[model samples]
Target: MTRVIDSAGSAYFGEAEGLLRAMRLEEALESYALAERSGHDPDACAGGRWMCHMLLGRYERAWEESDAIAARCKPDRHRFWDGKPFEGRRVIVRCLHGLGDTIQFIRYAPLVRERAKTLIVEAQPALKRLIEESRVADAVITWGEREPEWDQQIEIVELPRIFRTTLETIPAKIPYLDLPAAAPIAAYDGATDLKVGIVWASSSYNPARSIPLKQMARIFEAPGTAFFSLQAGAERSELALWRDRIVDAHTDERCVVPAAATLKKLDLIVTADTMMAHLAGAMGRPVWTLLPFHCDWRWMKRGEDSPWYPTMRLFRQPRAGDWESVVDRLQAAIEETIKGRRLVPPGDPGAQAT
Candidate 1:
């Protein structure tokens, strides 16, 4: 009898996993709920539900689900901070995700600091300089280094849940991340032409978010616009194919600070959903983000503007794997902006209608 019940529960969990992979989030959420009701790994079910709620922009519910999920998965070696008043207690916040996630969530560090006596932020080595200068925490340490001593530890992404964040209540503070003053990349030669920065690809993990270099060529069709390549990594090699059409501004020493400083110099930035989008938005720069049909939850379901970044505009694919239409809309918008019409600011009813 016990074996039969266990097998049935496993089957429900398997169905849920299949639905999630197919991007049928609503169906997947139901299947996961069914699995939980059947007593098949409550933690896994809670985690799956958390993602669904997050994607749907039901952040308050997602926060609750994530807390339950984390409680079940937390390792016994580390003490988890329960978002209590930690007066006089030391805390360590670990950046356990991508660079973009760290940049987005690090805003919460200052909130955590209000309660803790000492706060240490562990981040990727590439972001050490930027995080240190932000002063969100008392100390900064790179990942994989010796673990610093603290009374309790929390993951950076988990901070949102700890603070019980909702879409309406997201701390939409701009310019939270600061960059050191530096000369703009030489590519920005003093010109009155509309200077546009572009990032055509993202990390290889989710290729769906990326637009093929050849498909994006139409964006260069707009005359009198100087395009600068903000793309880094091996993807930068693709510039050779453009025949000097887009100037590459990325370099070995161009860390977050320099890259951000360069982004601020541009009149506009058109990028796929990547770290560049977050960096540009955080700096309060005018950034138009190109997103896949099923984009990350932060962008929400449908809209031209983002609540998190007031200066950022969103251009989403009409259908999955349809970058052509998105590019068409982007091109039209670019042409309009070059003609002296600014993008409608966030909170304007007209912008929401767009």
Candidate 2:
């Protein structure tokens, strides 16, 4: 989005948004306080502070705001888990956010399942097949499909808070969402050396989460690495321009399952901050996630590694709107890794990668 504030907004609030966008959490928190004092929306200011704390790895501070907001949002509620014990009660874990949100948080399903008499997940239809195949829940359902007997209900995002998640306490397990029976993409080239999958765009509503396809051109310059487009939507069409360089790996399949199948066959996945990134991480594949300077709370501002996903590495923009630098770093990292790989010289048992 634009750093320039529009004509109608309060100056303090505008500055706060700008600072937050740049990942300056300390300054953003102070600016949010100024916004609240200057008669800007108090709730909005609190929300901004809430995000800052979340990014700072201070879950307790963020939840303090959540508690206050939930109290105010009562009856017309946003918080779903009502802070009650539901041991032995049938629980319905509802996914009330984006596909990426559901995929990332669904790792907690097994924990919930262990405590409840039975757990059913109400997930988006696009993900129903994947979640079911993973066996994370006892059963998966979508909205308006069917109603099973459920005693306790909680939104999926609330699982972290319910489990009292701290940075150190995040469940860092891998292969959490597994579809063992998923067939490999029929068109895969079966490259044993190195096959790379790429997704350079995400929802248009959040352009910051997407990197322009042209920015990834340098990646194809590396020799001996096969590139494939795991990209979807309008961005997939952009692949036509680079046909000679990157393979269009997407299939006619409609749901998100194909990406999983495709990910399993690739040696590495390089994607924007999209559903594909979360999926690759959950599946225990090597993935490098390209994030904007000011990204979501889950990907805290300062790290190359994510606490939530063990196999995923993060590459954040050094500054706002600077995809060039991010791409430069990525290209260098790939070249280094390729050079780091040493051939074992057939049957030389001592040279195993381990």
Model 2 C-alpha lDDT per residue in residues 1-354, reported as the tens digit of each score: 223332223788899998998788899898888777766766788889989998999998887887776767645354667678868989999988888999999999988988999999999888999999999888899978886999989989888878878898888788988777666565564565568999999898799999989888988989667898988887788988899989898854457787788888888999999988999999999999999987889998788999999999999998888999999999998987776665554357765331
Candidate 1 C-alpha error for residue 47, in Å: 1.5
RMSD of each: 5.4, 4.5
Estimate candidate 2's alpha-carbon lDDT, on a 0 to 1 scale.
Answer: 0.85
Q: What's model 2's lDDT at 278?
A: 93
Model 1 residue 347 CA deviation in Å: 33
TM-score of every model versus the real structure: 0.87, 0.90
lDDT of each structure?
A: 0.81, 0.85
TM-score of 1: 0.87
In candidate 2, which residue ranges exceed 4 Å CA deviation?
1-11, 37-40, 73-77, 184-189, 344-354
Which pairs clash in model 1? none
Cα error of candidate 2 at position 157, Å: 1.4
Q: Taking the tens digit of each residue's C-alpha lDDT, what string does model 1 give over 1-354? A: 777766777788899888765568889899998887777888788877877787778888887886686667656333356657667889899887888999888888888899889999998887888888877789999867786688988878777777888888788888888765657556575755688899989899998988988888987878668888988878888889775678887754435777877887888999999998998888888999999987887887678998888889999888788899998898889877765543566456674211
